[model samples]
Target: MKQTGIPLAAPSNPNHSRSLSVGQSIRHSFARYRGVVVALSLGTLLSGCGVINNMMYKTTGDVMQGFSREHTIPYLMESGDLAMGCAMSEATAPLLMSFGRVTDEPDQLAVMLYLSAGGCAEDQGREHELAALAAMYERKGNAAEDAMIRQKRAYALASKRYLKSWQHHNTYYGESGTGECPDFDDDLDEFIYLAGLLSGLQALNAEIQSTSSIGVPKNVGSIVARASSCLENDKWWGAPMALKATVWAMIPGAQPEGEDAFDRLAMTDRLGEEAGVRLSHVFHAIAATNKGDEAMVKSVVRRHAESLKEQPANAEWAFVDAMATNIIVSISDRLWVENTGHRTPLGQLGSFWDDQQKEVETMDLDGLL
Candidate 1:
């Protein structure tokens, strides 16, 4: 009844004859007017809205009937695909936790994440309860402990699923041939890993909030740092991906993969400030560990106050940016176990794209805009 991990595209899009090569996909993404390449195809805007209910779910018929194999498969294969995949994956986590079913494909993830966000945002009593039940599987401890445990389970499961999606879409070397990357970095795979780190950090943050689990939150930050380190000192694309990576790595004790990734992915442009925000998580972690300068811990909160917008013309760019937004917001929201703000934690739960409950929705971009 469910799929697994992130699957950027379908297995095929039969329209292979008309499909753009990997290189073309990247170019098409950047040219706004080109609007030529984006998968949104038709008036994709709200086509799938029905499937989501109040969440704007789309119906199956809209996606599948007209979708070409070419569009689906290549989308699945591309780097940005993971962004959607992770979103979908996390969006749907609550259902997976409740149903005890998980999917292997990332597209399915879209539905999960969307749902998780919606549920968490609105505080649907039943969905939240079901999510708590799902948390029981991986977390340990008592009732209060259990509630927290459930929270961590949600974050970790979400984090793990998202990690797989980013790893799947990116190559350690990046897609230079396709101009899909910002620059060269061996340790960092373009800015995509940034998405992984963002999702992971959010997971860790949420997990920490739900539970007093000591190790997980720290580890989440560590992963963020590691992902950042992956691109450190490298010519990061200055896109959302790199910025996200920087923020995660900057988290005081997040994932300490090493200084290498950091050096490789450092900012060469204005991206430094955004990257700095990610590091706030690291600093917060450091404060928690007593290894950091607590004074610096305030940076994250301050950074969020700083408005930063990186326009993403295509799926990959937008996906990464959205992932980063959630991660950062979650960090600020979950900065303390006190969850003192009473802000609802972002559900690091499931995918937003799990239409297995329905059918694929499609819009013929050729006719839409």
Candidate 2:
């Protein structure tokens, strides 16, 4: 057997060699472009992730904000537990405020939360004040001074928080008294407006108590008094009038002509008592305390205690009534602590340590026995 070798034939078209070269060039170009395509795709994917994350955050913040305003606030308002409300506000404020980084800030909620948190700080300050009083009673001068320092520090913190509340309020509602009252969206909006006014006034009061330059505006008192007129005194359970009267009592010449501050306070007290809200009592007591009118303070407390017995708190606004009562109790405690070195005894809110005893018919009781 013999083996035969065959030679390959040449390409039919002359351009076949050119076509091969072109194909090779195309393949090389695609290979180089593949890296660039991969880079572009990765960049697009990362950009999409950023968009998705932002949308998620915004949605979450919106839902949380709505739920808090609609459900949480109303439920809290119905509750009578001031301590629990204060604690919740203090704990959740930071978490809620952080959402502002991703979305619009919840300024209305900030007003309420910061105000409540400021109250918590004020309560701490009161505790220190009580301790200072106790130390003074014991003649411990150094201990009293130290407690006073701590009290002022707590008050300073309270003032700062309250001022923040006032600032946020201005952000949300625009500068108050710049023009006509804001067109309130609903009852909640009106309520928040009132709260904002209270926040400004409280910021001023707290700064004064702190004895520190916390930068609270001195004109806040007058502003709050004027702003308070926006709310109807009767609709808000006499709170608006009480706020105005309190300003008049505190700020010299703030009262308008023919308006007696004490008379307005007395009228508001009756209105509050009738409404079962009784927030006016707090204002009256505060003004009395500021004036060093111990008798007036005691009268306010006694009247409040009597009103509680005469009329229960309105069911829809029990929390507000309860808070007013809590403040009254604190005032009573301060008086008791100052004189008796203790808080008011349980079941004796209206009575004092030196209250006059009523005469009893001892002979009739013995004969009956």
Candidate 3:
């Protein structure tokens, strides 16, 4: 009779009941803290995103820095396209410098970029100077004044940028004239060091030309002159000696006793010519111009032009040679514009307006007849 009725089920085991209760407790805890779990998941996702972003930025910066140092700079150095080099420096500097926000500041690259961009500005200033001369020759007083103003403005910009380049150079290689030279890793490093020295000198010169307070140190000329000793004059195509000589020529009392600035410049000229990198000629011309020695300036230009005919540019440093030629041409153009109201005539970089024409020996058709 008991079996016919519904039999009572055996009681569940206490351990089983306890396990069920624990499972419920876990679910309840999870439900209560669901918002916290979601927040944690979101935080993890965001943190991962930040890591990925940082990695991407780092990769981009590394690639840009490497490409610039390895390929871009070397290629530009080998090429003889001054305009293209200037354009590239002007265009890419901001973009490259922007990487500093996320990565190490590219101080080494900044030295080159600012140096080049300063050159671009200086070139524009030269052009304005030429325009001013042209306007003066034509008796256009207002135009001449405007052009001179523009020229000074450009020079001021150039001074600022050149100063920035020098600053970056110091940042990367320690300050020059610190009583110890940096241990250069390679030729490129040495070259950059030399460039930094040049940038410093140029900064001071440009500031003087600008007639504006660009805060270039007054002692930069002496500092660069001292630092130039770190480099081998002959190894760098006489550039070190040329730099030192220019400073001596420019700064009063800078010339040490028994050291003739002009004589040293003359020696450097020969050295530069033999190397097919006549940067010394530019320095010579600048010194002569500052001294108001028109004859010497013309002689330097003539020598440079003749040297170009006798020796082609060194293939390894064609761009540097080309740059020297460009500056020399600008100097010639200034002379031409002042006297003849125009730039140097095409194919006449070394020729001047006042030169005596050589007698041309013509074939005697009449004698043949």
Encode model 2's per-residue lDDT on 8-36: one tens digit a residue. Answer: 67799989999999999999999999999
Q: What C-alpha lDDT does candidate 2 achieve relative to the native structure?
A: 0.91
> What is the lDDT of every predicted structure here?
0.39, 0.91, 0.92
- Model 3 off-target regions past 4 Å? 1-36, 358-369
lDDT of 3 by residue, 27-104 (tens): 999999999999999999999999999989988998998899888888898899999999999999999998898889
Sum up the clashes in candidate 1. 107
Candidate 2 is scored at a TM of 0.89
Query: For each candidate, C-alpha RMSD in Å?
Result: 28.8, 4.0, 5.1
Query: Can you give the lDDT of residue 105 in candidate 1?
Result: 32
At residue 109, give the lDDT of candidate 2: 90
lDDT of 3 at 313: 90
* TM agreement with the true structure for every prediction: 0.35, 0.89, 0.88
> What number of clashing residue pairs does each candidate have, in the order they appear?
107, 0, 0
User: Candidate 2 — which pairs collide?
Assistant: none
